[model samples]
Target: MAAFLGMRGTGDWTDSDMRPKNWRQGVLWQYPNGDAPLTAMLSMMSEKKVDDAQYYWWTQGIPAQGGTVATLNDTTALADDFTTGAVAGQTIYAKVALAVAKHFRPGHQAMLRDASDYGVDTRGLVTAVVHNGASSYVAVKLIEDENTGTGTNLTDCDNILVTGSMNAEGAAMPSAIAYD
Candidate 1:
């Protein structure tokens, strides 16, 4: 079997939807040889990017695989990768805090932006989010050159509560709301 990556959510354990309490202790990946393999996970602990212990494990112990296995948990990085056109299999897991919806504007062509940096912008085929007055919604879209001009507006939900790692198919962004 191929080596599969293991992930354990490290969030508020007291919360009703909290995941595992320990992310690394029980987190593991089965390898051909029982030899313990290094692991890495990423998240935005605060305003800054947060990478799990695996980052140090790989950087210091084993070399990272060639693929861009990005844990999209970082909002800023997610936008950046998507803007540059994320690879077909580039892994990304993130937490979205707003309404996750799909958008398809016939004549309106927009691109994903780096919302993490607050002001930095990105240009991609998909529109990550659509700003509305004082609120924002996670506006995701599929803009594959091969799938364009299909004339179908693809949207799913109006919002998403705290959830686990999200795998972006086309262009998706994690929306944030201020609690002032």
Candidate 2:
């Protein structure tokens, strides 16, 4: 399993701006209290790069605030069409409704799961969107973290949720926020 890399510290518990002096790339700094969930406000900052380019971050929680964009087609065979019978490092082409094709764009983070059981789920980064008149697909490169099932089980991926996105390096900030 992959580990979350960062510093764990103790403080006065009142400083809202508390953070580690050294911030490593790909490390999500989470401060947890003994036997309880985080009770303090959390803030994060990225160190300035040598080139000074700017990057933006956005996040959406589960039971997505927006309406459903699409769901994995029930008829497709998961092993042959979606994943390589494993959870991570495979590029899965998830079939979705053509009507919602416009919402699955590259660079988006997609979270998929069975509606009845949330534990059977996976999250991946959208690498491509193929739109056909009758059928459409979202090609997602699976992120190696936080997957719960084999990911090849068709019944385990009945819902699709786009949680977040990351633009290309040096890309300008988006002018607006749109949710589907």
Candidate 3:
């Protein structure tokens, strides 16, 4: 998978100086592994100049070989697991098995949920990651609470699914993939 910053223009010439000033900038992704390319314009650079761009890329599923959900090492009651609760704007840490730690990258979106109950889930953005011997501790900033009640006592939640990622203009390009 790879992403590129691009612009659209009319009557464009081979010379870079001839590029249109009104041209809009956008981001494009190519999934070489077997998926259609995805594209979205930057809100600040949109034609209408509206700040409404909401772009995200779905994360690849857990490797079929041997990957499992992340486990919660602490509880919210003791201020250990999910330190500041599971509400929006809170950063929480979870223990991810090393086999799948590579999927949790900074700026990536993650989904936390109770494996037994799919209805209870929390959405967050990955902010930091630390790989320790056999597992990794991923720090995610809560963005939305799907159905978590009062966001209390969430020790039963043992799954951190890397759903997708949201990107904004000016952010650094993905380093894991080559860029054009």
Candidate 4:
């Protein structure tokens, strides 16, 4: 499938939590390929963005096709043609740290600031949440608008930030404020 991107946790392996481990290895995150006809293996690995470095290691040999998990046993890039002829069905795999972007929660809104050289502040409901291993991140759909009237107040937990305003009941940022 072209333009299809997916990531899953490898908790059953040596790096169970998916946390950045020892020195250089932390820069590598495993992506297992599930059952799907390969069409964009070459394009995927080249698309990984890591801060100012696009030189993130890409395995010349992609995992046997299925999905990201194909490289679970071996994270090395293979010399197999996973996008061309008979070997094109091989799995795709790669890894990188999550420090690549400003993280926000799904269905939540935030007054954001540009952490790097990127597009305008993207604000909208956190749409989809993807769990990598130890942490999870959400995808945001931009909602072009501004708040004018009273707004909902929020609190934080485990680093999930909430608005600094008070609740409707005049209560301060409270964890009891249910997440919408």
Please give each candidate's TM-score. Answer: 0.18, 0.48, 0.52, 0.22
RMSD of each: 18.7, 12.1, 13.7, 26.4
Error of 2 at 42 (Å): 23
Leading candidate by lDDT:
3
Which one wins by lDDT: 1 or 2? 2
For model 1, give the 10-residue run with minimal summed lDDT: 152-161
lDDT of 1 by residue, 30-70 (tens): 23133443422422133343465544322244221111111
lDDT ranking of the models: 3, 2, 1, 4
The top-ranked prediction according to TM-score is: 3
Q: Residues 64-174, candidate 4, lDDT per residue (tens digit)?
A: 211111211111232331221111122222111233112323334432222231232223443444546423243333344322222211110012222332224554543
Which RMSD does model 2 reach against the true structure?
12.1
Q: Report the candidate with higher TM-score, 1 versus 3.
A: 3
* TM-score, candidate number 1: 0.18
Model with the higher TM-score, candidate 1 or 2: 2
**TM-score leaderboard ranking:** 3, 2, 4, 1
Global lDDT of each candidate: 0.29, 0.54, 0.56, 0.29
Q: In candidate 4, where is summed lDDT lowest over 10 consecutive residues? A: 65-74
Give the C-alpha miss distance for residue 75 in model 3, angstroms. Answer: 11
Writing each residue's lDDT as its tens digit, candidate 3 over 1-180 gives 122334343422355563333322222222222233232333223455436566444455534321355555443222354433456786677776765566667777787777677766778887876767455777777797546464434555667777777667788885462112
lDDT over C-alpha atoms for residue 69 of model 3? 52
